[model samples]
Every structure is written in C-alpha cells, then in structure tokens.
Target: MMQEWRRRRQAKRVKPGDGSPLPRFRWWQLLSRSLFTLELVGPDGRPSSYAVDVRQAGDKDDGEVRARLYVDGALRMVSRVPARFPVPGGEIEVVVGGFGMKRCHLVAADGSERQLVPHPRSAEGRRARFDRDHPVASRGVGALSLLAVLVGLCLALPALAETISEIPPVAQAVGTFKSPLNLPGWLLVTVGVAAVVGSIERALRLRSSWIDDLAS
Candidate 1:
C-alpha cells in the first residue's frame, strides 16, 4: 500500500510527455555551483533561441543562478530561474512568458508545435573560443617592434653620415710619411686593416649579446 502511494506521488510531479496535462513543478533550490547548461533551438534546428547556464554563486548549496541570452550579437536579456527546475520549454512564442521569460517557438507546416530549450554555452562559448584561436589583436605588439626598429635606425643615421665624411687622422699621417718606395703607405694600410678587423670582431660580440637580450 505504501509503495503504491509513493508511485502515485512521483507521477504527480513529472511531465507525462504524451500530451497529457503537464505537471506544475515546484521551484527547487538548485545548487548554483553545479555546472549544467541547457540549449534551446528553433523549428529548423539551425538557429539558437535561448541558453541557460547553472553555476554556484554563494556559500549555500543553492547559489544564485544567472543566465545570459543573446539575439545575434546583441544581448536580449539576463534573467534568473529557480534552481532544480527544468527550464521552461516551447517554441519562441509559446515559451516567452511576457517580460520575464525568454521565449522561443516553432510552427511546423502541419501546424504542429515544436518546443526548444536554449543552450547556455553555444554563442557565449563560441565567442570565447574564436578570440582564443585568432590572435589578430596581438598584432599590435609586432607593429610596435617595427616602430622601435625604425626609430633606432633614425638615431644611428647621424653617426653613419659622420663616418663617411671624416678621414681618420692616422690615415692622413700615413699619406705624409709615404716614401718613393711606398713603404709607409703599405705599413699604414696593413695597420688600418688590422684595426678595422678588430673593430669588426668587437661589433660581432656586441651583436651576440644583443641577440641574447631578445631571446630572454
């Protein structure tokens, strides 16, 4: 007798799914922290109509619940539903309960009704994933690097220009010291070549150090 009574009680609370009288569900406090998402769709199944995300909001097991709804890129509404209740179902028109309910509906060619529940993560998650996969916004860093290179070249141009015009004093002395045998020019040329080679070696070491900085 007790088993039969319990069965009857259970049957009273859940939807029959056969087009019988639908049961009215009492709002149960949902554990907001539980991560459950719902998706609602239109008649063609290609368009999204609504979404519900469940998450914990506070110290109690029943945390505050918030949902974000969008139509195109614009936000349509933000609302809260009682935890533990299956979010309402129906086409856009049937489900939208006035100002508070985010509604979705579908009418078949035969005039039958198709109900859809919104997926909470569809549009929201897609936007986040797209941002992660595409790094176009980070191109600003590359642009700044190019600008820095240009500025450094500008500052260095003056030194390069000066080097082109001014002959080394040592070179002038060697010109004066040249003999009919040209021995002075030969010795000065050998010394100048050695000096240039040394300067090149020092420059290579400095370039290696600068490369190390870039790596770090």
Candidate 2:
C-alpha cells in the first residue's frame, strides 16, 4: 500500500548520529526545542535511558529538521523528523506536528507503546503539571480550545465552499454557490487566529486530529 511505501522511503532517509553528549533542555529554548525520555530494561536486566530531542529551528543544512536519539545521554542515532530508531526492546517513534510534537513514544515488540516523559522545563511538561495541579481548570481550558477550533471550522468551511464555487471550472459545472454566514474581515481574521492558538494549545498536550487540528 501507499502507506507502507512511504514508510520505507522515510526509513531510507535516516542516518547515523555523531557520538556527542545530548545537551540539557533550557527554559529559553522551550518553544523551539522538544525533549522526551524513556527508560527501558536492558539485556542485563538494567535500566537504560533514551531521549528523543528535536529542534524546530533545525540545522544549518537548509533548515532540515531532525530528531536525535540519545542513549544514556550519548548520541545514538539521528534522522529527519517522523523518525523511527531501533532500541533495545523495540523502537522509538518521533513525529512533529504543525505546532509541536505529535508523537514520541516507545513501542515494544509485543505491540505495546508508551509515551516518553517530557523534560520538566518544557512546555509539554508545564501543561502536564497544570493538569495535575488544577484538573477542573485544565478540563475547562481544553474544552474551550475544542470549542474555538469547532467555531473556526464552521466559519472556514463556508468561506472555502464559496471560494471554490467561484472558480471558473467549478462555476461552469455546478454554478456559483453562496455562503450562508458572511462576516467582516476582522472577525474572520480573529477567528482564524483563535483557531491557530487553540490548535497550538492542543499540541502542547500532544493532541491532534486530521479534521479538528489540520482543517482549521
């Protein structure tokens, strides 16, 4: 299938990493950097720590974004984003979303998976802490973000339809279509911006859906 072909193609893009120590996550780089860690049992029955680090600013090579895998603080492998690195028990999967990390998890041989823990100073870490500290408030904020995205989508779909209907080919085929809701430019811009922010908020919690997150 096409999905399997794409996966194989992406796997070919992976390259070995330089053996350098992984840098500590800094508070100032919270927005641009992401670090997630997992502990796995080694063959010797000892625990080994692995870390996945991604820098959105990317490297000097044409701003090519990559994910770096570190084992016990030393660089083990590196590849472009949406990487899969072989590990002791299984593999570490790393994927970047529009706003932040979409997936960062350890997958076991038996098909079990576990999300890596975010660095304490990272935005994701802060969001996790907030959820634990203020469960009710966190739920309210999450609901608001979903509502914002929903409203934005409702507004966007009509405009999109109207625009598509105006295209010559489409107009000739089905005639021009009118949008039911028309709003001022400023309000449309505001809703778009709110939707973007809401999507980012959801990204902080590693939440993403093609329709809800990408559509808006």
Candidate 3:
C-alpha cells in the first residue's frame, strides 16, 4: 500500500510542458521601497525578454509592460503587454519565472528594463572586513560601557551599606563640617580650577586620540 501511494505521488509531480526548459528566475520578495525588474533569459544563453509587472504590494493601476531583449548588452527585440499595472512599493511582490542568462532584467513603466547584477564586494562585506581589521575601537567602546556600569555600582555601594559605621572617615568628616556658606573662597577657587583643568585635559586627550586614529 505504501509503495502504491509513493508511485501515485511521483506520477502527479510531472509537468506536461515541453521537455526543453528555459532558465528560471522569480521575484521571491520586495522589501525596500524601491522598484525592480523581472527578466527572463532564453535557452540560447542570453537575456530574452521581460514582463512589465510593477512590483508594488497593493497598488491599483493598469498599463502595458514592455522590455526589449538584449544580446551582449545590445538591444535585440522588444516585447510588450497590453494593460497597465500599478505595483505598490513596500507591500506588493511581482513574481516572474525563468530569468537566468547572465543576468535578470525588470522592465519599468517607462519602457526601460533594469538588469540585476550580483556584487560580491557589497557594503556589508566591506563593513565586516573593516570590523575584522580595526576591532580596537569597537572593543574599547564595549569595555568603556562595562567600566561605566562598574563605576555606577561602586558609587551605589555606600548607599547599599547597612549603617554609618561602615562609612569612611573622610565622608563622615565632610558630613560633620556643616557650613552656613562658610567654605573658604580660595579653597573653592582651587577646587574649581582643578575640575576645569582635569576636564580640559581629558577632552584634549580624547581629541588627540581621535585625530591620531583618523590620520592612521
């Protein structure tokens, strides 16, 4: 019984078309808000024709779709459809079967077909290469973020402590020195200068590092 079922399924899978097959290409999806063409290649190892189907997801319109066949990047024959079709960008997908010679071409409404070419050296590939080459900056940013989290935890540690008994003497002394705005002017000025100088130094160091990086 199982053999009979398997034989029946295999028999049903046969297509009754001509045995001579053309190269097949189909639009699997359209994700970006961009228009594309669907080109079909003939059996003779060249781009033969294109369907004038606009690949908008939910557009409503009708027009003729035409594209010229090309050989060695030269125009050969023009094929046309009778009705105008609106392809909605971002929501619709147009499917074309059998598009493979050297490339696939999608015919636009303006009677022009755009060929799809494969690029091995794409932007994503370049980005991966860059990450592989100069990983220090990325790693440094991650390390700095982790260090910031650690510093935040260290600052919070005193708050988490059970009692003032565990607090440091310097913190206790600063708390006890209650002043009615009686802090020394010279001491305040000195502290302010130190803060400014420290901040400027850090900024200058970072700027120098960035400039050196760019120059490298």
Candidate 4:
C-alpha cells in the first residue's frame, strides 16, 4: 500500500521534457557526476535509450540535489533525488546516499529490476570492470572496506558515549563515563579518513548497510 502511494506521488512529479540534448560527461567531473543508461524496446518495437544523470554538487539554480532523466539524448524529466521516472516498460528509480548514488535501476512491471550500466569512463564503471577482471581482489578490497567501517564504529562509539556523558546536564543526570579505548588524535584522524574512503567505495558499488554506511 505504501509503495503504491509512493509510486503515485512520483508519477505526479513527472512532467514532459524540454527536448534539450543531454550534457556529455567530462573526465574532470567523474567523481562529482554519475550517468547510467538503459536501452529498451517500446511497444511499437522502436528502440529507445534512457539515461539518468546526477550531479552530486546540488543544482546551481536552486541549490537542490536532483536527478535528470534523458530519453534518446534529449532531456525528459527532472526531479529531486530518490526520483522515479516512468518509462515504456518500467520505471527508472534514482536514489542518493551520503557519499554517492545508492540506487539507479529499472524496475519492470513483473517486479524484476536491473541496475543501469554506468558509462565506461565513470568511477562506477571502472570499479565494475575491476570486479569483473579481478574477482578475488575485488572481494578482498570490499572486505577491507567493511572492516574499516566496522573498526571505526567500534572505536568511535565508546568515545562518543564518553563525550556525551561528560556534558553538564547528562553528567548530573546519569553520571560521568570514561571511554576505555582512547587513542591519539592522529590515529583518530587516520581511521576517520579510512572510514570515509570505505564508505565512498561501497557507494560506488551501490552497496549500503545501516551499520556500515551510518558509522562511516
């Protein structure tokens, strides 16, 4: 029921395109931009190409983060992140996470879904290619990223608790607390940077876990 409501709401958000050509992705904007494409055959047996483009650095005009859908190289629709654009056979869903995109997939009428392919020169595409060519190494890297985020959570949680406990109101109400795993500032910074990188890496693969993503 809730899902249906959301679909209806998103459907209302859809509007006709302005017929402007889609902008090309540039090499320097690889980290800040994302583009994914899907090719489908319409009911009339015509081939159509759809692309989803998102610029992480919020829109310049309104400073709102948005996703733009392009059809056959022309602008089709635009909406805020976590958008849904209805298409021929399915809807293209776009979602954003803290570090980057969390979802960009084609959801079919039969309920099946497939992630759109990233452009070859994009960061996501490079990562996907690496995974295909070096499965074991890719797995190891993914494991390390998870481990880094987990370690950050373990170390930061206690410190966070202690800091909160030391607040005047909290201390008076619940007593002071000391964290057992205090470390140097340098070490904390190092761990924090690693956690951030790990989170970005996970985002590149469209993988997210509450514990991992939130902690990182």
Q: Each candidate: RMSD to true structure? A: 28.3, 1.8, 22.6, 2.4
Tens-digit lDDT track of model 3 for 109-193: 4656444332114222232344467788645643443444344333334433424434578556654232234346785565444
TM-score-sorted candidate list, best first: 2, 4, 1, 3
Predictions ranked by lDDT, top down? 4, 2, 1, 3
Query: Candidate 2, residues 12-89: lDDT per residue as tens digits?
Result: 867887889999888799899888988888999999889999997887777988999988999988899889888888
Alpha-carbon shift of residue 112 in model 1 (angstroms): 9.6
TM-scores, in order shown?
0.19, 0.91, 0.17, 0.88
Q: After best superposition, candidate 1 residue 171: deviation in angstroms?
A: 99
Query: lDDT: which is higher, 1 or 3?
Result: 1
Those runs of model 1 whose alpha carbons end farther than 4 Å from true positions after fitting are 1-49, 58-63, 83-216
**By lDDT, who's the top model here?**
4
What is the C-alpha local distance difference test score of each model?
0.33, 0.85, 0.32, 0.87
Cα displacement (angstroms), candidate 1, residue 212, comes to 63
- Estimate candidate 3's alpha-carbon lDDT, on a 0 to 1 scale: 0.32
**Which clashing pairs does model 2 show?**
none
Total clashing residue pairs per candidate? 18, 0, 15, 0
